[model samples]
Target: MAFVIEKPTLKDIAQMRALVSDEVKRGVILERSEEEMANAIRSYHIVRDGGEIVGFCALYVYSSSLGELRSLIVKESHRGRGIASALIESIKIEARDLGLEEVLVLTYRERLFQKLGFVIIDKTLLPNHKIWADCIKCKHFPICDEIALIAKI
Candidate 1:
């Protein structure tokens, strides 16, 4: 099936929220309340596989200089189908359009991200709260064990 990627509408928030939160529960991504996702619908994107919302990603821009790739996930059945990679490229395009100099991710998928052009980095080098804002909510916060990775956009 051809997967179509685009920004999520307010109407798409509920299903999108379920997919994202499910990923969090699986430890593939971080937790986000549906309320929070609803509040930031414009920042999220969904990949429709012939009308099924099988994948989604979000780019939370901090400024012209930086952005964070948050809540990236693909339906489990669709894993290895390039679904996540496509969603990631979509976010990179968004960052480039905003003239962001850098985009970062806090993830355990080190090899996967590295193949996508992300480089491991000292978490300390991230922009202030760039890690903290979300990390603080993470159960692993303050003692976050996720690896920090960045890809200069």
Candidate 2:
């Protein structure tokens, strides 16, 4: 099957929320409320197989020079079909369009990001703003076990 990666619309919010919720339950990604998804809808890119949203990812810009790749999830049935890589590539283009210098991610899938040109970095090297704005709210917080990776855009 072919997949298209493109910006999501308001109508896509519910399906996007459902996808994230499934990953959240599996402890693979963070949970996001519908309102949160709606507010950041412009930041998201989704993979559609016909009319169904099978995968999605978001680029959360922190500053003109930095953005974080977040909430990347490909349905289990759709894994290994290059959807995730395509989504990341789409985000890289968006980051460049916004004049961002780099993109970062906190992930357990370090090898996957590495293949996409991201290098492992010490989590502490991340900005205090990121920590204060989002990390603090994460259940893991100061004890986060996710690996940090960065890629130049």
Candidate 3:
């Protein structure tokens, strides 16, 4: 099957929220709301196969030179086909275009991200105020098992 990556639109918010919630329930990503997803829709990139969304990722810019990749998810049936990789690449390109020096994520898929050039990082060097703010509400906060990683843009 052929795949393409594109910026998600408002029309895709509900589908995106569904896909994301599925991943969260499966422990692949964090839970989120349609409002939050819609608010960030312009920063979200989705991977489509046969014109249906199969995967997605978002870049939330924290500073002029920094961004955090949030809520990356691939459909269960479509995993292992590089759809997630395409979504990530789309975010990386956006970071580059935005002149960001680095992008980071709190992810369970450390190996997958490492393969894509992200390296593990200590939370201290990251923007704690920004991440910690949202993380405070997370069920996994403080004791989050997710690995923190960053890739230079």
Candidate 4:
């Protein structure tokens, strides 16, 4: 099967929301409202298998020097097909094009990120703004179990 990775269109909002909502319910990702997804649509990359969205990822820039890789998910039927890896690669290219120095991720899939050249890092090393802006809103706030990782662009 051929999978195409590209920026999402406004028309993709509904499918994107549905996919994200599924992951959120499974506790695999945070819940993002439709408005939030629509507002930040430019930051996302999606993989389409024919007409269906099979995977999704987003890059949230913190500064010229840093970006956070967020909301990576692949449809369960498409797992192990390297769709997630391709989505991450797409995010990296976008980050490099934006002149970002590094990409960060707080992930439960440490080994997968590490395989893609991300290294484990102390979560405290991340910027304070990230903590205040997003982490604090996370349900796992004070006891976040997600491991932090970074990959230089």
Candidate 3 segments exceeding 4 Å error: 26-28
lDDT of 1 by residue, 40-129 (tens): 888887888776688887888887798889887787888998888888888888899889989899888888889889999998988886
Q: Give the range where candidate 2 is weakest over 10 consecutive residues by summed lDDT.
A: 19-28
After superposition, candidate 1 runs with Cα above 4 Å error? 26-28
Highest lDDT scorer: 4
Give the better candidate number (2 or 3) by TM-score.
2
Clashes of each: 0, 0, 0, 0
For residues 27-58, what per-residue lDDT tens digits would candidate 3 score against the true structure? 65777677877777899888877767878888
lDDT per model vs. reference: 0.81, 0.89, 0.83, 0.89
User: What TM-score does structure 1 among the candidates reach?
Assistant: 0.90
Please give the lDDT score for candidate 1: 0.81
lDDT of 4 by residue, 28-145 (tens): 6888878888899999999988899989999999997999999998988999999998898889999999999999999899999999999999988999998888777677777889
With a 3 Å backbone cut-off (N, CA, C), the pairs that clash in candidate 3 are none
Residue 143 displacement (Å), model 3: 0.9
TM-score of 2: 0.94
> Model 4: what TM-score?
0.94
Clashes of 3: 0
